[model samples]
Target: MTHSLRLTHLVVRVAVVALLAITAIGATAALRAEAVVEQVPPGAARAMWVWDTSNPQAVVDLAVARGIGQLYAAVPPNVGSSPQLAQLTQLSTLARQKGLRIDALGGDPGWVDDPTWVVDNWLRPAIATHLFSGVHVDIEPYATPAWQTSRSTVVRKYLSTLDTLVKAAGTVPLEADIPFWLDEVPAGKSTLDREVMRRTKGVTVMAYRNTAAGPDGTIALSAKAVEAGTALGVPVRIGQETDDLGTDPVEVKQTFHGFTVAQMEVQLDQVVAADSSSPSFAGLAIHSAAGYAAMTP
Candidate 1:
């Protein structure tokens, strides 16, 4: 839940109309959501998290210019009746027309406790609009203290919740946002990462480190999971942080903020270059769109 707050997913329910929030992106842009499902980008496709759908035009334009192929656009609750439904649809149409895939993104740590609520209120309605191509949920059960003590229980509920979404999503692919360290945790007979991969479409590891190489760098931190994903034939998208998380040393090292977009891309390029060799490495996904665009010139 706290991959530096994902900050976007934390309150995505409130700002589902903006298109500027960038998410994990791929290397090459795709033609449609159908083109993206179960298929990782050919090379280093880029994905952006667009939580703010307020400006659909700006969002699509930015994504196209950046060569981003996927948009994890947030979905508003009561989406079937929300005033911004048309705005969301416009964004979707524009994105797809420009060869970009848009996935309905929604999640809350609490959603794990009651998947039906989200299914009935958010997922079903959003999917009904036929505005999205896929479903991307960020249920970070780890954010709660219970994750430290009741991890097993939480993992069970979490997996169950995903199952419900997977079923409800029907033919639409469902993916999740997970921390980079999930592979170490046990989920029944398999590791959490592997289990999660088995349930959803694929995963975007919140690998948030700013550098490409180091003991704690992005590549090193995410490599094991990528290998596991490869073995399972699951796609993997490595995520980077751009939001400014001031001060805390460990946290500070996790973002690309304060650096220019060019500087951030250099690091992202390194990640794409390093991981592209793996079949599961579908692409790179930046954590936020606004932050990515706001990066220095």
Candidate 2:
């Protein structure tokens, strides 16, 4: 063969080799990006609820044993009846020892709209004494049609009160446990939406109902709750009930709620998997410590 022809053949080989190398590099980069995008693991964090004077230490210990890392203090009304201060202190001490975090410091839902009087009267005192990481105002304003139409007013007041309390506490997070329907409050309610997002540290959609949605039904409801929470720019904690959903004999021989702990975990997994892209998909919190402990998964 001519020397010139030989040189041309060598050049072609070099170009082909370079092209293959580029293709391999591009493929590797694409794989890395995909992995990053899907890095969120199912049920990466477990959360549970704790009520006043309920042996928070035992609850925390049980939670830590089951890979649960969050505890929300349930501060209900009839404040005189509940040992709010003592429970908070006990939980705080136990939480510190077990490497746990206080996810919330309020209770029994609907405190979100009970007027600023309650916050100033009850919440402020609790925060000053307990030093929890946040407050969980489980407000079900959707039950009130008046609040739904005039939601901005109720939302603003609730958020304002939270803002004041957070300012007093300093860096403390404010979270809310809300109903399933609030998921689609609509476009003009953007003010309400932004307020809900801004005032609280995070939003946990309470998706549980006693004798309510069946297993598949529960999972579908939770997915919608998470989707709505995402649009509002808030992290969602899905609340699952152990005593409800009947009893699942297939997963566990024992009969309880048709929804076993395993079923609840499946629902949670669905929510997390639905939006792996948004870290706003905070984590899953089972309703109460007792319920969580009874749950299989």
Candidate 3:
């Protein structure tokens, strides 16, 4: 072959290889982004709620046994008190030493009327302790009697309260617990799910269901919430109920009762299958430590 022809051939071959390499790299990056699931900070594989901080050792032991790396421990309304503050700090240190994240948990629909109190009394004190990694609020405005009479106004107030709390939290991450059906509840132009995701750092969806894949199950009901969170870049944790809520109305009772650990694991697997592709899929949270520990399987 002529020298010029040989040089041209070599150049063409090199260019083709480079093009193929670029295409491969692009494809890999796209796949990685698509499969990305947000890992909850402190690397919590499973999280459980703790309603009391009186016995920090007991709570930590139970959490360690169940592979729980996060605790949504309840903070007393008078959290600013010296005794309460000391207890929380000790609990936080113990949990952190075990590589667990502790988030201050507080909520009351009444707080909606005075969100400033929620921030000043609860959030600010929790942050001042410097023990909590984040704050988790379980304010269900719909539980109030006024919700039945004034749905729109109540929901708007709820959204406004969350907005204020988020701002008050400053650099500390704020997470809210929301019902899976929030998508069905309208709050002005947008649904509750959209507004909450837009305001909070993350959300724990109370996707209480016996199963995970059916029409009324956790995965199906949580679809809209996951989608909204994913779009807004907010992490979402699917929460399951393990507590036995006795003799409540059928609808209310559906939030808890009747689930073994094995069954819950199965349901969580389905949730992961359905949502693992989303960047907002954080992980799973059991309703409470005591209840979950009592369950069979």
TM-score of 2: 0.65
Q: Which is superior by lDDT, 2 or 3?
A: 3
State the weakest 10-residue window (summed lDDT) of model 2.
Answer: 1-10
Q: Flag regions of model 2 displaced more than 4 Å.
A: 1-43, 76-84, 107-114, 144-170, 186-188, 191-194, 209-233, 244-258
lDDT string for model 3 (85-191, tens) is 77778888999897778888989989888998888888788778777878889999998899999999898889899989888887788888999899998867888
In terms of TM-score, the best-performing candidate is: 1
The 10-residue segment of model 3 with minimum total lDDT is: 1-10
Local accuracy by lDDT, each model: 0.77, 0.52, 0.71
RMSD of 1: 9.4
Structure candidate 2, residue pairs in collision: 109-138, 110-138, 110-139, 174-201, 245-258, 245-259, 246-257, 246-258, 247-257, 247-258
Cα error, candidate 1, residue 89 (Å): 1.3
Whole-model lDDT, model 2: 0.52
Off by over 4 Å in 1: 1-42
Q: Tell me the RMSD of model 2 versus the true structure.
A: 18.3
lDDT of 2 by residue, 152-259 (tens): 665555566556655655555666666555546642445443456555666666566432235544445566656655675567666655543334543232112445
lDDT of 3: 0.71
**What's the true lDDT of residue 5 in model 3?**
8
